[model samples]
Target chain A: MDTEQQVMDHFEATCRSHGLKLTHQRLEIYRALLQSAEHPSAESLHKQLETRLPTLSLDTVYRTLATFEQLGLVKRVETMSSQARFEAKIEQHHHFFCDQCRQLIDFTWHSFDSMGLPEALMGVGTIRGKNVVVHGVCNDCLEKKKKPE
Target chain B: MDTEQQVMDHFEATCRSHGLKLTHQRLEIYRALLQSAEHPSAESLHKQLETRLPTLSLDTVYRTLATFEQLGLVKRVETMSSQARFEAKIEQHHHFFCDQCRQLIDFTWHSFDSMGLPEALMGVGTIRGKNVVVHGVCNDCLEKKKKPE
Candidate 1:
């Protein structure tokens, strides 16, 4: 099986192992995450999922998203905005945030041999690895600035 | 004048220039932020400032902090944590997050220009400069790991 299929199979088995009921809402949230190219906020996800899960409550969306975050199935995208967004990619990588357009783009560049975190901190919290986020303007934003005054 | 006094004077003057009412709550909040070595959350600031401003409502604390953030007197520290934290040091520098202690330690190795963050990010929502936050285990965590017989 391909990597995507392999991941899905694992997720299915893992959910079963964890005794989490795979409700329609949970499945829809998972599908919405998988389908989105843009890292989507709960509000965005709710809008997308509304077509299928018409009766879905906003609270349910938040709860489902929170559950996926806890399960390590999705990663939260950081923005200066109050609303939270998330991504489905689970691999070790970095992010490029476009300050102008408010876009979060994926960037893959690994520079560290290990986490290089200070040795003094551990057990206080579980930090699995580095989630390096680099902020800058994307190519589109760069082009927009070249327009005449 | 000392560096701290200079910063306070500058901040107070800036507040005046903007016609922002520098109430006791604002000053108390500013003092609390200036005193904190750890990038502290709104709740943390509220707790600290309350000791001085007993009549200060949580709403006032939040509003004062929001104002401080908007006035460029403080910068928001991004984290995966739910609550937002503010950095008192507005100068360009990176942070060393102690995952164990949940503290943000500032590391000023080089100027923002020296970091070489792409110029495209400039002027986009105030890309003051680049900061390389190295997330890792601190020295204390490493010592504890080796202690067990």
Candidate 2:
């Protein structure tokens, strides 16, 4: 994973190569995505940036994130929810999503990393990346359920 | 995996158990999802069902799918794309998504199926399901890229 500054620099270089202007909104949106560990959606990002960027609209945030996605500078985290979540960490990792708490936690699986693609997927595609999302009730939620009201 | 008829019967049972009316629209939407392997979005489903149900609206499709999701009658296939995709097959399986062609293929990994949850996730949550999505350029797209147009 790149350092925060390195990620920002790469973002700028990628924008230059794509002939896209490094607008304030775009930079802020990318920064917000980079800084957040929660894999926030556009609406959440817009809300976070509202005080700092009072004039920033949610539509602009959505469009900027879409452009970043097109440039391969960011990734959209897969979720069962209707809203799309964005992340700037383009690293090899998996997610553990708590269905009860709605928390998305990232964890790396070395065994999976070492294991090659499954035999079943041999001819399916030119494999780029694999992501696993494990959905369950988090420990805290389970504890809460255990305790009687 | 349940047979198509079995899946539909289960849907009816679930709706009835939840006290949701087994309305024509809901039944048709669930039927379309059951029949489709594409994991279509609400918009695509609405377009597919429009010919059969002239009065059905996209909003209804979206709402019905949401209700079905809340009721655990359908599973939303996670995708990087903004549009949410729905699938009625709740069995243990995985997906291979082609970024270029936008094709979502389902494949079962017995090894993954047999292997218990990774050691890292032991305390993170009470695991219910693990879904793997592999993203890549499909074979056809790679062939197209190789051939000079």
Candidate 3:
């Protein structure tokens, strides 16, 4: 994965090289995604972009995200939520999902990137990539539980 | 995870002890999950159970799977796919997802279950549970691509 600047540069170059049209909505969506520290679902992105793109439909946000995925501009994350989420395709990183808040926090660990596939898997299948998802309540959620309303 | 017989024994015993209602719908769904060698989406599971459960609705299939998950009888896998898929809670194992065919194959690498959370993750918060998902092209998919249709 790359940083925000790198991702932006790649996004622009890819769009330009491919001759893909960068409509206002698509550009804003990409910018919003790059700025978000957490992977944002389409609905959440739409919420974030409401003031800028007042007329944007949820459907258009969904379609644009899919197009971004096909163009290799973003990655779709399957984080067990009802809504689909998108993350800027940076380098290899893992996610800690705060189930209570439905938030995904990213962290990098070099060991995981170099973990040779165990002998059993390598023998049967070709290994392309892997991700370790540590799923549980985050401190924020746990602390919230402790506090009384 | 446990063996098939053990899982069956636990399932039956748990249902009996908790007085969990096992309607025909629930039992058939459990059997479908247990017998399946692959994680299946609701649509796929419904298709499998259609003949055996002529009156079964897709909604019913979805609801029953959720109930089973809550009861700790099944695990919902959040792989990077559009549809929600599930696994029968048998033992500790990881999934190998084939990008080409959108298929999930299970493999066991015991070390992962005991993998120490790297130090980076330790300082931030509590560690609960983690799953390792290896994504790549499966042998079958590669073989299919090689041959003519």
Candidate 4:
């Protein structure tokens, strides 16, 4: 859903199906997650919403995100960082993280996605999902490193 | 590095090389991380070490782990879970995480490792490392699911 209205509609429907209340805070949180490309953490989300939502507490953001995660409304972006990052986009994709700038970029791997699970993990479990995180320096950071002061 | 003494020797050498003090708490924390296979978070580590070191606080565990991570002595295991997990094993390997049981198992992907980075990721950045996380229900959890109470 590209538009805020579309996202709101989806959010309302999802909440209804899951029997969740369509609170203003929940809508705002969901909208923020949908708009953000940074894969923000709960703390970051709270900070982002604080100006608009002067009364919103960090605890509320944490609880709402946890509830959304439990219902699969949002997916957590796994990273080497201590704080957990999150995304509203739950599509099948991979991530490229720039260690220098600490940017989390999403990229799809059609070949890997089509190949299915690796032979190594065959008998280990009932497979659900797979994610690949590539760590490196992004082009912008690399270029910045190449330039002398 | 299998034995505790071997790990201690390596830890001492690493600490000396990195110009870090060989404090008793740091040594114990490193040893505990080396011994654990759970990819325990700082809170969990603090809980595990508290009885042994009554004065040890969760903040200490967090700070020590961040220091170790900075020094490349310990690596963080990325996961969908909110809490960040850590491991002392720095070798190149991937992980298999059981969503139901929350168990993190290590496995090597020689084929994927040998193949190198995918062409899709080419020209995007200066590649450093890659990790694959497969999420699923472990055999034990699957077996449990099969049996009715």
Candidate 5:
């Protein structure tokens, strides 16, 4: 099986193992993350989710997203911006923040597993264990600059 | 000169170079950061600074601390907690976060700079490069486990 399928299987098994009910809310949130390319804030996700699940509480989205983040199905990217952004890529990778648009793009095909931070670093709370951030303008932003005659 | 003195001198120089007026508020905030071992949240720093500069505004403390963080005179450590934490150790190093105490400690000896990330990882918007975090329990927590009554 391919990686995405494997990841889906893992999430399903994880939910079962944790005895977490795979409710409509959970499935909708997971599907939303799976479908989304933009690193969206919880508020953004809530707004998108409202169209399908009109009765969904913003608090429920936040709580469920937090749970998914803790479950390793999503990533929370830290920006200087007030709203927190999240991505669904589970594999090891880094991100680039568009300075102009403030969008985040996944810089894939990288792993920090061999980065060799000291053993003591592992002693803190559950470390996601690695961090990598790249910030700059995306190609779309660059293309926009070329648009003016 | 000792490290703290050297750091203080550097802080002052950095301020002068940046054309920032080195106010008592800034200096006191820097002093608190320099003297602190525990990575302090802005609230904690404000409380400490309030003792010395009785009329200092919490907003001023927050703003000044943010300015220092931006100038690289101090660093911010990401936490699961709501508030961001600051550390005085400006060198390229990892951190040890205590899950129970919500404490952040400096672990200065990691040499991950030589661990080359792949070229594909260097995409646009890669600003200021990368930082690595290896989270886990610290030695103190491990020791705390073995305590006998």
Candidate 6:
């Protein structure tokens, strides 16, 4: 089976075991999230799905995504923007965000997992996950600055 | 001179150098940010300043924050909530975010700076700053879970 099919099957089994109904709309939303590697907000996901599923409401999309989040099916990414964006937990990775344009780019590094976590933090509580965000100006914005026109 | 005073002076000098007006309202907004270790949103800041700056409007607070951010006088922290929050660049540090209640707590660790960044990200663009977030259930929430109401 291909990666997408495998992902779908995993979501299906997880949902079934948790007694979550994999309705058509829920599945479509999950598919959209899996396909959106850029990490999409609820409104953006709604816009992308509107053409394909004309009758889909933004609220339903939000509710479904919220459910998925509750079940650990997705991870919400941090952005300077007011909108909360989300990404699928396909694997462990870190994000590079452009402070100028608020663009979030993700990439993985094996070294991060092996880094010694501070004992100070460990004593505070149980850590579920860790994320690092490298912030700077993206190439597009840097180029735009170089050329006024 | 104390650190806060030095920070305020730096902000004033930066504003002057950039030809940005440091009006009374702007200064108050900056003051609020400097005092807020919790990193408050514009509305929260406005509410906090209501007594001393009774005439200040929410829109004006928002506008001032936008100007301060544009001037590099402040940094916006990413929270799970849709309300965008701002923090004064008092110093470099990381955050501990409560996954249960969405509380963001700041703490610093020097080891993160020594970790080598992945070259794949270096190829993407220029990186100026980095922040790490440790996600977990806070002590309060953990206790609540242990005793169950």
Best by lDDT: 2
Report the backbone clash tally of model 5: 11
Q: Which tens-of-lDDT digit does each residue in B1-149 have in candidate 5?
A: 35777888889999999999989889998899888888888888889877689999889978998898889888767565657778877777655556556566766554565565556755463355555444556666656777934
Show model 3 residue runs off by greater than 4 Å.
A1-7, B1-4
Cα error, residue A149 of model 4, in Å, equals: 8.0
TM-score of 2: 0.81
User: Mind giving the per-residue lDDT tens digits that candidate 1 earns over B48-120?
Assistant: 7776778888888778878888888888887756688987787766666666655666765543335344443
Clash pairs, model 4 backbone: none
In order of TM-score, best first, we have: 3, 6, 2, 4, 5, 1
Q: Per-prediction DockQ scores?
A: 0.24, 0.70, 0.70, 0.62, 0.41, 0.70
Q: Using TM-score, give the best candidate's number.
A: 3
lDDT of 3: 0.83
Estimated TM-score per prediction?
0.75, 0.81, 0.91, 0.80, 0.80, 0.88
Cα lDDT tens digits for candidate 5, A40-129 = 878888899998999988898899888998887787776646677777777676666676898876765335555455665544445545
TM-score of 6: 0.88
Give lDDT: candidate 1, residue B32: 85
**lDDT by residue for model 6 (B8-116), tens:** 8998999999998878888998998888777888999999999989999999999988888887778778777788888886467888889887778888778887667
Ranking the candidates on lDDT from highest down gives 2, 4, 6, 3, 5, 1
Q: Which should have the higher lDDT, number 2 or number 3?
A: 2
The alpha-carbon RMSD values of the candidates against the true structure, listed in the order shown, are: 4.9, 3.3, 2.2, 3.5, 3.6, 2.6
Query: In candidate 3, residue B65 scores what lDDT?
Result: 92
Q: For model 5, give the RMSD to the true fold.
A: 3.6
In model 4, which runs have C-alpha deviations exceeding 4 angstroms?
Answer: A1-8, A50-54, A146-149, B1-12, B19-29, B42-64, B146-149
Q: How many backbone clashes does candidate 1 have?
A: 11
**Model 5 spans > 4 angstroms off:** A1-13, A78-82, A97-102, A108-112, A118-128, A135-149, B109-111
Pairs of colliding residues, candidate 3: A1-A90, A1-A91, A2-A90, B1-B90, B1-B91, B2-B90
Looking at model 5, give its docking quality level: acceptable
TM-score of chain A of 2: 0.90
